[model samples]
Target chain A: MRPLFVSGLCIASALGAGLEESFAALRNGTSGLRPNDFEPFPHPTWIGRVDGLESAPVTGALARFDCRNNRLAQLALAQDGFEQAVARARERHGAARIAVLLGTTTSGILETELAYRRSAETERLLAARDYAATHGMFSLAEFVRARLGLEGPAATVSNACASSAKVFAQAARLIEAGICDAAVVGGVDSLCLTTLYGFRSLELLSAEPCRPCDERRDGLSIGEAGGFALLEKAPGAKAAAALLGYGESSDGYHMSSPHPGGAGALLAMSDALARAGVRPGEVDYVNLHGTGTPANDRAEDAAVHALFGAATPASSTKGWTGHTLGAAGIVEAAISVLCLERGFLPGTLNTGRPDPALRSRVVLESEQRPLSRVLSNSFGFGGNNCSLLFGRAG
Target chain B: MMRVFLHGVGVVGPGLENWAACREVVSGRAPWGEAALRVPVPAMLPLTERRRCNAASRLALAAAEDAIGAGDWPAVGLATVFASADGDGAVTHALCQSFAAREPEVSPTQFHNSVHNAPAGYWGIATRSARPSTSLAADQDSFAAGLFEAALQATLEPGPVLLVAFDLPLPHPLALMRPRRHGLAVALLLGREPRGGALAALALRLEPEAMASPLPPALEALGDNPTARALPLLALLARGEQGEVRLGAVGARQLVARCEQ
Candidate 1:
């Protein structure tokens, strides 16, 4: 697999609103999680809510698409000169030659939830909300494309947690197939009632900030985040890192639960290594999809142990951002690129010690080390799994 | 442009059942008529799994099952791309209604079933396939997006690829918002190499300022469903004719598919 350089990237997570701020937070161990403060129906769980969304509503020509999710997306797009990077890519490869692919689970369903409540109050038919533009699963992609002023082929992957991560794979194939020369791939999932109360019903929410891989780990701390990467055929000589390879697979077991044995997780990791032509030993760091759930951490530990053994330096950055759901893939991908660029390896945050039962060597503290390659894993509901390998672009 | 061979097809729409059963009707040989859309329960799934399916998943899996059965390759190893314009509308409506009513004890089953890839997940379990599968949405252009993704995968990899595009009318109130009039699903088995039962060779390109081919008069009523955007391409395949048709829009560009038998 030929590497596609990530010439430009931007991220807005619980940690901060751009690459620099988020990276600084990661370096300084500044957690962005707070007790449930989301208003009107606050569930008793920690959340990684982005700041200023209420005041930063989507405005201007795209105001009709206003919602928490798109606001998060707009915030990310405003950071790190991502919009400028996209503008450059558009000039280099025409608007129609750059595809827009994004991932999100609930998207603007938050608007729908609010709309439903309003309708119940009014006792009228569900009022028309620009359903397609605001609440549709493709709304994130549509908003991003229109915001970026690109006219390329576009689509939105909604495969749960694996949603945004899979967009990278889609962009790679589209470029390889000559469907597009470049692509703006990213994901955005904001705080929504569907996920909040939904996860609570599943008993998958941790009362404290998520402690990934901790022996006492209970469940995930849901977070809102958005991130994007510009992928192109040529390795931007000055680019910090490139997408070396990606692997995708399904559990074929259960929809809600991961395969207890981590069967699909192991397969996706192995495939990523094989495609990148990198040996397991070459993966200097591993980004675990440690959502802090006992089953998830344990299952992922088994898979990582089988592949990288007990020696690889691995950690779950979820402690920093909570589980960003559909945005997890790109958020972690951006973190992986940061690892390659800054020579830093982030340890699992919020966890004091690795689980006694877990076998993988869980790094408990952030460290500085030159790294050439890293693998990030994102597994979602419906048994969807994706592993992306990034390497320093020489 | 990207090229792929259409190896098999499965379709379910108003007045249509499966691809094998409706090919003649689509080809203009048999008289077309409207009937209530009945999405068969996915028997391919085990009982436990079947019970978990919603209308969207059932419609997608039924079409996928037929396409996989008709294709040359086994279902186990083929990659899949599932597209839905509106995913699990019924579930979304239910979840929102529960919250709206302040009865926030959302059903665990409904939460899991709410993911857009629920059908792909159910498909994986039914076929017991570990092959990579993706679920995407492109508003009304979902079918074209799924086809483009599938064709690209088939061209890049060895095995056949399955593309499933499906959508059902949103339950009212919500339906009052989006207004999809019918339920429809279409699946295509695409392979890089021509198979013995190949329907046609398709070349896909993205063009600006193009419109999707108008549905035949007989199939016009089905066009209200977003997934029915596949009807034009299917109609061409049904007649065993060589021609070009626009699949649908991708942002400001349109996907133009040229079919040759």
Candidate 2:
């Protein structure tokens, strides 16, 4: 099968908007995480939050459906010549021929939750408009589709952290099946009390910026981000990056923790390579699903070592991005594509001393290297693991 | 494009616990269960593993077990796609409450259960199958979407594909959104028809006819007891309902079921 090239790609993350801003932060090894600033939180926890959301402006139609999450998406979509790319796609394929697939865990549910709490009548916690927009997981996708004026298939993938990464797979299948000629695949998630408290309850939230693959790594710092890519079927098209292949697997070993042996992780990596028809040696770098949790880091480390050997350069951008949860997949995938486009691998910040167990297999700091193919990993809570492979467009 | 066939199915929801029970309920021989019970998949995993599975995962496993028992498990490059309207709501709610209490402690078990694909992952582990699996969600049309994804997967990787759709009612305040009893439905599809069984070709058609009742009874029934919809269709097949049956949503999005004798 020919590669599905990413003709245009953009990211709006905590580090800042646009390719230059985000890449500059990665190159400088700056962490986007900071003390929690979102009001309503009872206690302080580190977060990767995008500033100036409350003051962000929206038009009449977009305003009616606007919320913090969609606002984050709007900002990201406006960066890196993204709007121009959409306009070009509209001219090339017609608006109805393009599809929109977004991945998110909580789609405006935070706003709905707040509304319910403030409702005078418990029976009707949500107003009709709010209920229509925020009651379901499809709200985020609906908002984007309407905003972009996309008439083709518009859907949401909510498989936890792997949500956005799998959006690529869905979009690819849609194109391969001749359903759509082009697709916008990405994810958007915002920092909300619900996610912050939820992870805190699970003891998975760190008080400090997460140090992935480090010895003293405590837990993950939840963050918010939105990333998008324009995938076209023109195999010969000039492109920034090409999606080589993707592999997905479920360990079903546990609900929250990964299999100790990393069996499922291994399956996902191997499947992705097999689909790409590339050997492990061909992979130049791996973007790991390193959440900094004790269980997660260990399992991911084991899988990486077993698959690519210890010599393959690998790093977790989560140190800078603060584990964007559902948005992690697409965000990291976008970063991986950027690596192929820019030829510099982002370092795993905050790893002063690497975990002894990971020292042999992990890349603790950033390094520059010529990269042809990069494998990005996104593993979610339910042992749902996905590995997406990207290569420089030929 | 390869033709995908729906060979075998199993469902556990509301008043129906098995294929026979589903047939009875769909044929009006039984009333829907006021409350839902988690049905364990037969021999899909060890008893110990089964004990740890969540309600959605258990229902999916049970349905996959029935589907696989009826047909051979696709050995090479099979893909698993699981869908639900509300994914692990109880576990998500628990996670939220734990955060609200500032407990700084969460059950690793519950945290894992919160994933949408937990059931598909568990099935792969138990089967020791390394094929790629996906967990998907699309609100009330989850079943139709699952079927579409399964068909798409079959087209991409031509093998037997397993699709499971299940959702349980939320606890309290969350339940007010669309309160209903618990339900689950499972269907197994193959690129080619299995040795013995009826075959069905699934297609999607956008019709001009708007539903007289914007919300169709079939849609409501399926939403409340998704597994029950499969039983009625199967019972119709058992009773010789031929040709195609069209189930549509308000916007003319319809799933066309073509059953062959």
Best by DockQ: 1
Model 1, B56-106: lDDT tens per residue?
A: 999999998878774457889888999998988899989988887655679
What's the TM-score of each model vs. the native? 0.98, 0.88
A272-342: candidate 2 lDDT, tens digit per residue: 88988999999999999999998898988888889988888888899898999889998999899889988
Model 1 stretches with alpha carbons more than 4 Å out: A119-126, A235-237
lDDT of 2 by residue, B1-261 (tens): 224666666666555566556656555556655454657555767777776777777777777776666455543345788877677667765655554343334565665666666776577667766566777665655665666677778767646777777777677656666565656665555555544553555444433343311222332454464333344346555455555554322112445555555
CA lDDT of every candidate: 0.89, 0.73
Q: What is the TM-score of chain A alone in each candidate?
A: 0.98, 0.96
Instruction: Point out where model 2 deviates above 4 Å.
Output: A39-44, A57-59, A62-64, A115-124, A127-129, A235-237, A359-361, B24-52, B69-71, B74-78, B92-108, B121-128, B181-186, B193-198, B203-238, B247-255
lDDT of 2: 0.73
Q: For candidate 1, give the lDDT.
A: 0.89
